[model samples]
Target: MSQDLYELSATELSASYAAGLDPREVAESVLARIADREPVLNAFYVHEPEQVRRDAEASAKRWASGTQLSAFDGVPATVKENIPRSGIPVPSGTALANPPVSAENAPVTDRLLEAGLVLLGSTTMPDWGMLSSGVSSRHGITRNALDPSLTTGGSSAGAGAAAAAGYGPLHVGTDIGGSIRLPGTWAGLVTLKPSAGLVPLHAPYMGRAAGPLTRTAADAAALMSVIARPDIRDYSTRPYPSMDWFKGPANPAGLRVGLQLDAGSGAEVDPQIAAAVQRAADLFAAAGAHIVELRPFMSQAQLAGIDAFWRTRSWADYSALEPEQRENVLPYIARWCAGGKDYDGVATMVHYNRFAQVQQETIAATRDYDLVLSPVAPMAAFPAEQPMPVDDPDLPMAHISFTMPYNMSGQPAATVNCGFMLDGRTIGLQLAGPVGADDKVLAAAVWFESVRGDAALDWARVL
Candidate 1:
């Protein structure tokens, strides 16, 4: 029963409580599984077993009384460490910890609690959500579920690893530049980076957005419907009507998808990844969607400007840290930050102007299409401990070339596991839609999942 309980989806888990499966037993099974696997996977920063059991017992009562709070009642979930939850210390994956526990939940955390999703614990991340690799100063490396030798992609590293390892059905991760999508792609999971203002964020950064990483598209939608609600704390948030994302587009018959093989950064895609993206496009084309090949929407100069903008933000944060505290940071991130310190106000404005231009061009390029498709990363998962792909340390953003554009445009984007590489590492197909078109992007993802089937979820269960 314990093993079987661990295998159920969030929807399945909730339904099972009424079908004679005790929530307490399910919680214990999850705790036992975590105890056995945490040392090897390093997927969690903390797990409160006693608290989890208490919550499960209460949830079970709700079920017994036919008073379940929501569809996710008693369904296990994990939140990325960067997001604040009441009583949880958000170290932001850094060595400098013992930060005070949050007094209240961030909007996303509050919604999860309100929806009755049982949080297992906070997952790990890179220092200050800095790097794409899953290695962090506090928790070390979060290994990939499929191949432990490879990285799980970060800074949403632990969330991706936990979801891929079947720790739970839903995990929340934050993305500034591909944090959620990259990890989800590398870990063979479904993830979304909702349009910037669609999901409220408390972070000081402008582009960062919180979203869901799950095994199925429907699960991602379920979590998003709750997390994307407007919050007064986030002044930038805009009210969006509730959506039924589980019932996505019935088919791709009327969707227009623009397929981009490269972003014109001069970096070549690994042949295997390109082939997989092509296959995904072919599948959509065959399903009655009109597929159009897209040219580079932004020039190399514009792309580089976006990279500089991110580094400039990092520089501000890093420079403010005490000198001793900075010394404890990852060398790669520290060096990246140091490089940005020389940019003057005029240079910053120039980059901002370029960023705006890039955003305009992206919107213009996709105006004719319902969504755009590309490879989530240029290559498959690399070694677990490295900050960037071993051969391209100087070009740190190369791996996220296809993903950062949407982040800059403030458009919704999602990654779906398309197929596996010859080395067994998974590849992801990225889907990006116009600003405020999150539902359309998700609908297309669900349609693709229908075609591809839930093979990734099935594979992860046995890992």
Candidate 2:
């Protein structure tokens, strides 16, 4: 029973454990999976076999006494490297000063532990959670579980891989750019990027928020309820009535939706990806969502200029690093920095103002829609071995074209498999809602996940 449940997702495992599988044995089975998969995936950097057993044994005892911590108490999960666990060293793959760990548990981790989740270890993240792709010089590249030849979206690459590989019941990841969503989308898993500041980001990196990448959307919602508790660490965390959230698995009905078709730059969305987007839209329409296709806040000219402006910001963060700081820095990062020294503050402000105007206009447009949908990336996951996409310059900010603006706007966004591409990779379609409507956005994604079932991605067969 434990072995069977180990292959299940946190949601499925929970359902099984509740049905009488030994919780302790179930934890050990998951640990076996982790040991079996870790070598190639490189998903975990530090995990002690002994501590894992202790936690699992404790959970088993709780179960025997009818004292389960929560539905997740005995489940195994991984935290992103940047999410400090009391004594863990956080070398975000770069050196400015080694960003130290928090003396106490991060609010998100604390909640997971309180709910009885077994923290397997920390997953790899790009240096300071920077960049779009998972390739890093610091802690070697964390490859896509579906295809080691393909890239995993970063900086939450390890979390994505672990979920895809079934290393644990759930994978805890953080997203500022498309971190959780991109990797999950690419890996054929479920992801949730909470509305900004909803998950407290303490210590190592202060700005980004944390969330989960799982095999099911319900797990994301469940994790949300646990971590969304008020914390003095994050001053901007939302105070919504979350007690009733995740209480049910209701499907979205009659929800209002908007679709952004022409992603501004006129970069042709791949044929397969477009079809997946339409498929998702059809699902929404059938479910009674009033679907409206509209162009919002992006135009050909505006996006081309934005393509250049956003790339420049990457330099500010990476350029701060000393040569010694980035021994593992990917080569393309240097190529991007080649001409950045010439950019002036005026050029930067021009980009900032344009972003401001577009987002302001977009907020007005979103007023009528409960959700806005688009493709997660202009292209599907590309080969991992290549340092730069041949279309490098064409990639706005060098490969992440569609996911950044929302991060800039602090909206709650997510990516899930829309369908499979002609070449055999998954196409991730993105959907977003205004800053605080996370649960509603996830509800729609959950409905789509059910409809798209097998179309959801995982690389078990390919890997």
Candidate 3:
């Protein structure tokens, strides 16, 4: 292959290993790439090249003896800093909490290690995983690899940068709201937020799931095949059968695909992103699928209510901290949590109830369609120094309206690059499906990847 080992996809690396390529060599290539890019991107909180080399040596031995643990045995990969790996401290993107080293691996980490992936290190995230931008108090800002001045959307900030910079073939990120997809959008990658509980997590929340960020949808599916397993640890884990996640392109012909151009709340969609989504819809229609225009299913009241609930949840955590520790938090995050401090019982209950309402509305609106297409975010990547798209703590969530509803609804959602902005930033097209439709959503993503020909990106020259 013309590309270097570090540039290979996970599937490609697997094949090369099967053909007798040594994992150690691949490991060195990735280490060099990381060293070259890390200074500007600041993508990882932990990156130990010696440890990576040792793991790669072991994988090389396994391959040499015809006893490779898995097809992905030695492929480079990263986990978000928030996901605990036994013996590693999870800072949750804040400097305030001095977390003890974890005694056990997060379920996602267990699966990644078990599959024999070379653990590159933990990636950076924003304070408390609250902001959509990459600014963090603990690890500093993670810039977009494609364009350093721009934000690598978070809280999957570093994971996005790592994947885009070819630091690895697989990166695990958790999505509660739009964390995974938003970064995937701005960073130009394939990312998934599985149906809630489909990928069991360590400390599961309402809409959080562990998923992959890779350059290709197929690579995302390859990573999903390992991580989306049942773990007794997550009470919310769904009872799902083992799936053939790499099944070929889904037949789009005769499928009913919904086009959602309006989020109905928050920031208005940028013209470039809106047009890109429409182009995606046109491609689906051209491929023989029925494209239906969808009415906005979410309202500003619903968005505000959910925002209020989140603020309180975060404030509760902040209020419990010592004053100095609380002061250590990012100022933007502090301001955002301040709104949660004074909610009365009635107001709190009303805000909490919005989740059920949002969920119900999302499911009801999409029940008639096999898939729905929309923009992953309202606009392209923002300034890296900013805390959020709007740069206002009071309006921190203005850009998440398009991607947050699916998290509440527990639907499977994905972001795939469909186009690019004139300034060269990526425009992500989001594809969502009804709850329990992980396979369908992923398959559709793969199909789209095949049809969305030649994105014309060159990461080699990006830096």
> What's the TM-score of each model vs. the native?
0.95, 0.88, 0.98
Which portions of model 3 show Cα errors greater than 4 Å? Answer: 454-456
Off by over 4 Å in 1: 1-3, 97-100, 390-396, 453-457
lDDT measured at residue 97 in model 1 versus the true structure, 0 to 100: 42
Best by lDDT: 3
Record all residue pairs in model 3 with backbone atoms less than 3 Å apart, i.e. clashing: none
Error of 1 at 445 (Å): 2.0
| Model 2 lDDT per residue over 389-412, tens place | 343633445334456556656677
Better of 2 and 3 by TM-score: 3
Best by TM-score: 3
Ranking by lDDT: 3, 1, 2
Residue 437 displacement (Å), model 2: 1.9
User: What's the residue-level lDDT of 252 in candidate 2?
Assistant: 52
Off-target runs (Cα >4 Å) in candidate 2 are 95-102, 203-207, 247-253, 299-323, 326-328, 337-339, 387-395, 398-401, 457-463
* Ranked by TM-score, top first: 3, 1, 2
lDDT, candidate 3, equals 0.90
- Global lDDT of each model? 0.82, 0.71, 0.90
Better of 1 and 3 by TM-score: 3
Error of 2 at 113 (Å): 1.7
lDDT of model 1 at residue 249? Answer: 53
- Least accurate stretch of 10 residues (summed lDDT) in model 1? 453-462
